[model samples]
Target: MDKNISFTLKIWRQNGPKEQGHFDTFQMKDIPGDTSFLEMLDILNEQLIEEGKEPVVFDHDCREGICGMCSLYINGHPHGPATGATTCQLYMRRFNDGDVITVEPWRSAGFPVIKDLMVDRSAYDKIMQAGGYISIRTGAPQDANAILIPKPIADEAMDAASCIGCGACVAACKNGSAMLFVSAKVSQLNLLPQGKPEALRRAKAMISKMDELGFGNCTNTRACEAECPKNVSISNIARLNRDFIKAKLKD
Candidate 1:
């Protein structure tokens, strides 16, 4: 049977990157349990608009667990208490009636507050710009199996490729590190044949960009892997370290 539940929401609000921010509490009544977390926010925003108040600002796109745009810290957990799920995939049923849910943005220097829950995650884009690319010959369409890859290797690469660049790992880490994100990108390409040629270059360049963006160091607490919506493995980080070391040695 389906039912509705009420919740007390304590959501963070900010005007801009340089402005001070604070939490504003609101009462949500009789919300459908099957409603997604983002949909619940939509309801609150609609109420605020009707009241002639500013609607809470947050990031979201493709609310179907892809795109990774729904980045919210709910009740001290990135993307809420659910494991392997994005905020948009989180249902209101996970909470009880009268629960106080705290919502905030990703709190990393690399991701400064842009408005309320939206942060300047362009630092991630910069890191990817530094190396997340391949140099392929201008080509006609090739056969599907033109390059025969081992099944296990292809599967591993696909797993790493599943990363949506959500930055949940950074939000969940105490150090606000971005190792898991960088490593996943690095690993996905490194495991494939075409990426091998530039593997060393990609590793060093991306890591350097990540460090330059004011993101913190990885403490190996595994918080990143635990919070990652895509479940990107920490083993990729090991591969990244090795690749970085090898790149340095080559230099």
Candidate 2:
């Protein structure tokens, strides 16, 4: 049986993107060990509502760790203290009976906090819109086996495709660089045959937009990979650099 535990939550509170932020303390008592972090927040919100206090604002959707909407910095780690997991997947059992857990939004200039724990991650969307897709006309959807992609290449592409566009990389990076995220996005498509035609253009455009959006340059620190929920590799960044250089050389 899972035992209940008590803890103190110091969660960041802010009214808007331009407003100053600070931590608001709340006492959580007798919470089930199996309760997910988000569920615990829900209970806290319920308590606040009953007491007529304003509820904490946070972003979440598809709590199964797919959408990457539950971006949070718990105890100085992006997405709590779990390895290869998102904040929604984090359970209370990870913490002891009386621990002070600090929760904050992703602290990056590129990802400005919108309210409390939620930030505007639409910068990622803008990067994607810059050149994350294959626009060439393929007349019809071909059968899966028709393309004849080798096992190794296909596997690498699949691994790169696993990136969920979570901004944990930005939050974990000391430079606030989006190289890991941008590289993963570029690699997944560039490694495939359908995306080969415009690979050079894709690399240049996405990287340009990332810079235009104020994301810092990659400085070889692997902090982003260390804190990534999907385990996206830094090697993709190397590949991105090679492609970007090739694009520049051709110009």
Candidate 3:
């Protein structure tokens, strides 16, 4: 394979959150196959800079796929061709020489576009701030085997812990439901002993915050799990519903 491959990029450009947006086409020639997707965008920005034009801005941090900061909808997919992959982890080699790629920001009313491919995901942080953390301190240290939790229970908690709060679930959902995300958050803590103290309150607070943020209700279409970079399970949603029901019963 040639190290230098040429391609076409149709990128979304919006001046601000309030401004109307459109796609701008640019033909990239002799690009390195080794360059990551974001790196390709970097080169394109450099070219625009040399021409005395404004650079394209996109969100990115810790490109290693953990931070979930690379919030982008590339070629009709949340991240790109690779499943459970981040934009910064995507390589140019995934395409042929003449492939025409469409790059856009995550589209959702709750997440207004901040720039070209960057949207304000502070909505997630707001939801978390509502009651995502365990406030009570368990200062006294106990033995590791004191709880004797089953392996399966611990595994479920780990699965929920895998959620990175990427907002891909909202972007992929037609109704913009954050059910999968909220479910994962609740599941991680609900299944464990440490989280039992705040289980009811946590669900009520986070769900209330989610509605206040203007997110839509979950109808169980399952599109979110398909696009999620973490591959968060839909079963977590059921787990969340159970917890919510239990909380309501206590009231």
Weakest 10 consecutive residues of candidate 3 by summed lDDT: 129-138
Q: What TM-score does structure 3 among the candidates reach?
A: 0.95
State each model's CA lDDT, in order. Answer: 0.95, 0.95, 0.89
TM-score of 1: 0.98
- Candidate 3 per-residue lDDT over residues 1-251, each given as its tens digit: 64788989999999999999999999999888888998899899999999999988899899889988997888888998778887888888887889999999999988999999899989889888877777775698888898888999999899889998889999999999888988898888888998889988888888989999999999999999998898899999998888888889999
lDDT of 3 at 201: 88
Candidate 1 ranges with C-alpha deviation above 4 Å: none
Error of 1 at 205 (Å): 0.6
Stretches of candidate 2 exceeding 4 Å from the true structure: none
- Backbone clash count for every predicted candidate, in the order shown: 0, 0, 0
The CA-based lDDT of model 2 is what? 0.95
- Badly placed stretches (over 4 Å) of model 3 are 1-3, 138-140
Whole-structure CA lDDT of model 1: 0.95
Clashing pairs in 3: none
Error of 3 at 120 (Å): 0.6
lDDT of 2 by residue, 1-251 (tens): 68999999999999998999999999999999999999999999999999999999998999999998998899999999998999999999999999999999999999998899999999999999999999966588879888888899889899999999989999999999999999999999999998889899999999999999999989988999999999999999999999999999999
Task: Give the range of the ten consecutive residues with the poorest summed lDDT in model 2.
Answer: 136-145
